[model samples]
Target chain A: MSEITLGARRPVIVRRRRWRIPGAAIPYLFLAPATLWYAAFLVYPMLQSLYVSFFDWDGLSPSMTFVGLENYINIFAVDDVARLALWNNILWTLGALVLPTLFGLLLALALNRRAPASTLFRTIFYSPAVLPLVAVGLIWAWMYNPHFGVVNVTLKAVGLRSWANGWLSDYTMALPATFVTFIWSHVGFPMIFYLAGLQAISKEYYEAATIDGANAFQRFRHVTMPGLAETHVIVLSLAVINGFKVFDLVYTMTYGGPGRSTQVLGTWMYFQTFQYYHAGYGSALAWVIAAIVLVIAIPYIRRMSRG
Target chain B: MMSDVRRQRRLEQTVIFLGLLALSLIWLTPFATVVLSAIRGQGDLLARGVFSLPKKIAWGNFAEAWSTGDFSIYFRNSLLLIAMKVPLGIFIAALAAYPLAKLRFRFSGAIFIFFLAGLAVPVQVTLQPLLVMMKQLGIANSLFALVPPYVAFGLPFQIFVLRGFFRLIPSELLEAARLDGASEWTAFLRVMLPLSVPALATLCIIDVLATWNEFLIALVLISAKESRTVPVGLLQFQGEYSSQYTLLMAGILISIVPVIAIFIFLQRYFVAGLTAGAVKG
Candidate 1:
């Protein structure tokens, strides 16, 4: 019995010895490329942004003077532009969250029942989400043109001539008008998401509700709504994040135009950093935007994880 | 009572269907207008209502936009970028994800969580650094500059999604391969990849859509007119012909065709891919 135990133990000892030296190293080999790439590209750049936030560095100029938190202070004290941007960001978040979600749910509810050419309608409805933002922006800008554009022409034909104005250029209407375009471009995405979520729900739930004398509203409220919680959370979070980062559409359509009335944080940051060359101030603004998103999202993420 | 309820449901369904038809029209009208305007000559667009039928169709607008906007070059650039970036991104992501999914490494969870944190970090935050790095690498304003950052920013999400997918594969299959004298690489290549075609197809479709439609990164990175992707090229055309509404619409229509074609062709995979990324752990 002793000799047999020794014979088995000898191989076990050798295997353990082999693991100690090479097993620890092998995983690192797998990790090396990703680790290196992340450090050089992601981590280092983040630190550099932080460092650059303290100095006034015109991206090309050799002269770098540290302004400490003056950039942050100036951004808060004298910049109504930044304030407007912050407000626009809030409006964007609200508009993006409410409009898309409600419209998507409505579309999904409407399309739930079989109809003629339902699949074709569904595809057409979802097509906008696939188009590039620039294409959408350019298309809408043409439609919003003051003369000979589709929107104004339609408004005039409908005898709403008083409402016919340069929608993209008007101070009172530009942001909301632009928001409508943005909403139009993005509504397809949420619609599709909601549709998928709605489809995932078993018809049995609705059937059970029907047996229990539940009407359409009740079925939707209790069955569809609850079934769609995960989709809502994902969509809501994405909407908020994308709202906070609204750049391309604004940049393409209005250019924060007609006296910066349509400015959002992203375009503001772009204007300050790349256009105006206030790198430090723009960095500060970028950080503030990041900080706001982090504050809102981290708690939400934690809540989500717990659930 | 049951018959009455059924009648009411039928009425509600009709109302709902009509409402959806209106909404879908609202959604589709803008795109339809662009397509119509693109095929109509400038005079026809002015003479008729924006949504009215064109008296004369100018199928030449597509060819005009293609030639004048130099879209052939832009299309080629976009195609090249997508071709290179998608495979590179997927390969890197798969390689990175395999160990995270299958290997019993000590820091694998930590590493993965680190990448998960990347999901919240917007590309805007990384733009400046990426620009600087690209400039330093001497590839700024070129297609090469666009590729690396595209891969880098894309890695975390791809790896995260692919890892979730890889985890869903049965461990017994992997073990069987291992028992058959297959090394880890061989096991991953032979056993795992074949099982992952559906997931891969989904990822490929999503990647193609995203990279094809991507604007901001291209806007920041590619400065040369000749090097610009379709989106950037459209912006340039807008600048050159800001008042020429018909021409601008033509450009918009041209730029959208490739993406729409891809979406229609692979819409099932697109829907599956998006939802999987959204819902998966």
Candidate 2:
């Protein structure tokens, strides 16, 4: 407690604390880097896009004339392309939401049986989910080729040669063809989620049901379906948001063609901004898409945060 | 009664196996065709369609595609960006997550929610201004231009996972370290980080896969040919060689090999991470 001893201890403490941040400031110091990155890159840009959406500037110009709500108005009133894009977005979202969940639940049920080679089959089914969407588009585009592609080749072999079509380039068939590849890659993703949920359900529930003379279907209806309710929300919301924002697959495969028939909101926004130089209009489209995703996602996110 | 129950279970297993086997074959057919097409020569492909047996294996197509497609440049750019971005993103996220999970601070709940909300905001909504910002910073069309946004976008999920992990690391260990006169920084580096290897590794795998396969951002930001990443490069390669299906397939195979290799190596962690994100957080 003497002054000289205190002075000596103080220097040692100062030396140790030089590299050690104080406890109160520790969180802030740790947070500074990530917060700054998000602020400058994500938050700032998000607000900037919102502001730009109300204007008529062509991206690179120095002056932007405010044309409040005009871009959104045009999407409904005059822009057939926008209407087409919105319709396609809906088709993609609904199909992805329904089919993937059904197929995923099916696969999860199959795998949950603990059959032989189940792990291998799970990996096989899940493999496509990891490949880049660009690669998915390329592989499917080749498989959909009218002359030598596998789909056509298989159809011809099966005595259904008439069913074979130019899948991606045929305007009427392109969207459906694209959906096949989407569903194929996505089914395994939800399967994994459902598998996790299935694993969490206790064996006691099934045992109790079985003792009551419940059949297999009845056990599944009472036990499995209710157990996976949370996972369904996660899977369905993710599928819907991703479907609304689909771009890479469409861009790589059809480039919004055979006459823009496969165009969705995400790619159409890019076409408006980068290709046509209607940057303000694209910003408007982007906001609308983001709004749709938020409308789907926010409720689930709120529920998650609460728990 | 027991014998009947066992027999029925055996029958159910058989049915499940056969069903999964058939579906697995369907799932793998496209990949098999991609690989098969990649090694077949144009002459062979023209003579006998994509599914036909190859009489002569043309391994030379890979070499030709490697050189002619300029995939090497694109691969290097992707590797460079991933190498820079993934570790930095994980480190920043883990650092922030530590206090949020362990240390009690004001507005921590609100801060956590804010980060979670970032997950729902699609990147397209911010694309224009981000491009403008990249231009202002003089990094547009360069690998450096991609880093900031990539790191930022990756942080929300990484932090969410890490916070869950850090919270499980009993506070008793940190308290023990403090009692031994360890500073907070030293405690983090020496105690917490070493315990977090599995979580960090999971994040690394996820982020690397995401950055390597990222398409849309690279497509929008990098216009220069040399600056393009693998996905964008492959897309342009397909555009230029639309009719050359064999070589195009080679390029596709080349692009996916690394990701498949990584997945095979770390599949357990990857699966755990995916489920953890859904089930827990």
- Model 1 lDDT per residue over A5-116, tens place: 7754653212222223364665566667766676677767766777788998886677889989987887788899998999999999999999987887777766766866
Residue runs of model 2 more than 4 Å from their true location after superposition? A1-15, A19-22
The per-prediction tally of clashing pairs is: 0, 0
Tens digits of per-residue lDDT for model 2, A170-218: 9999999999999887887899999998898889999999999999999
- Pairs clashing within candidate 1: none
TM-score of candidate 2 on Cα atoms, chains taken together = 0.96
* Per-candidate TM-score against the hidden true structure: 0.92, 0.96
Best prediction by lDDT: 2
The residue-by-residue lDDT of candidate 1 on B12-119, one tens digit each, is 777777777787777777887888878888888887767888888888887887888888989999999999989877877777878888889787777876666565
Native-to-model Cα distance after best TM-score fit, residue B184 in candidate 2, in Å: 2.7
